[model samples]
Target: MEETISLQDLFKTLKKRLALILTCMILGVTIAGVVSYLLMTPTYQSSTQILVNQTQQEQDQFTSQEIQTNLQLINTYNVIIKSPAILDLVIERLTLDMTPGQLTQHITVASEQDSQVVNVTVKDPDPHRAADIANTTAEVFEEEIPKLMNVDNVNILSPAIVGDNPQPVDPNPPLNMAIGAVIGLMIGVGIAFLLEYLDTSIKGERDVEEILDLPILGLISPIPESDVNLDNVVRTRRKRR
Candidate 1:
């Protein structure tokens, strides 16, 4: 026969092993807090914007063909902005230690649907460095694109500026700790039930009857030593009488 557990039994099991569950949850939260606060590195983000148009007059010359051409070329421009040709100049101007590919990996170029603005974002461990990278990448692209594409379409819309209190974009300690605590609680509950299932020692009359397949005749009450001594004295008095 299959064993079925009810809500009352489940609650009893959890109640019996509440200490283990609580301990696991507390340990998990402590470890998560320490790791999030002390071990994880924070990352800061900064972004700059660049405007893309065929020419100052191209806005008046809006057509399906012109839009398609511009969209197709935008991907090429995105690639070129992160290329060695542009990033090398940016490195030279900023005197950065990183290689072109390393700098490129930190940068991201994005454009909106049917919009002429391209947003360039950079992430780094330092806020100021992130801002500098963003601004420098934009400026370098602005200067290089006009010469390479032979069109003065790229213009700096907004330069990346240092934020007053820039926040880290990564290593959300509170969120991480909360998630760890939840996982730990689940693990603790699982372990508690597993131990309860593995326990074979009988603690109740029902367990004893079920395991041994015998009816309990009677239960013996334990007598205290003081009571036994008083009974012995009473018996000796009766004998002397």
Candidate 2:
């Protein structure tokens, strides 16, 4: 025979283990908050934009093919921007103590689909350093692309600048805490169910019937000690009085 539980049993289990569940949840949230707010390092981001255009700006009107050509070129330009050819110069200009690969890890190159604009973003512990890396990468890429690709199409659209208060781009506390709380709740519920399953000792008449697989004839009541010992009962009553 298969065993099954109903809504009443589920609610009863939760109620029985409510203390353990609450403790686990509170502990999980507390640990997550502490790690998110104090232990993890905050990373700030800065972005610089570069515009890709053809050299023949004298043409008052650019055709659809001309715009599409520039957009296609932007893809090649994106790869080159993060390449060693550009990153080497950026690292040298900034005097950063890292290899091209390491520098590339902190930088992100993005451009909208079918658009002539590229955005270069850098992440660092120092906001000013992030901005400097972004600006210098854009500058170095601007100078190097014309020589490497033999075309002068890339132009600096906007340079990065640090604001008075730049917020970090990572380690969101509320989100982390919420996730931790959910995991803790699942663990707690699992433990409660495991304990309930493991408990096989008979608890009442219903349990006895379930275990023995027999109908309960009746319940046997125990005789009170006072009824068997009248003198002791009288003495106990007098003492209570």
Best by lDDT: 2
Candidate 1 yields a Cα-based lDDT of 0.87
Q: Per-residue lDDT for 52-140 in model 1, tens only?
A: 86664545567788778788888788888889999999899889998998998899988877787888999899999899989988888
Residue 85 lDDT in candidate 1: 97
Error of 2 at 3 (Å): 1.0
For every model shown, what is its TM-score relative to the native structure? 0.80, 0.85
Q: Name the regions of candidate 1 deviating beyond 4 angstroms.
A: 56-66, 205-241
- What does candidate 2's lDDT look like per residue over 81-162, in tens digits? 8999989988888899999999999999999676778999999989999999999999988888868989987889999999
Report lDDT (Cα) of residue 123, candidate 2: 96
Residue pairs whose backbone atoms clash in candidate 1: none
User: Pairing residues by index, what is the TM-score of model 1?
Assistant: 0.80
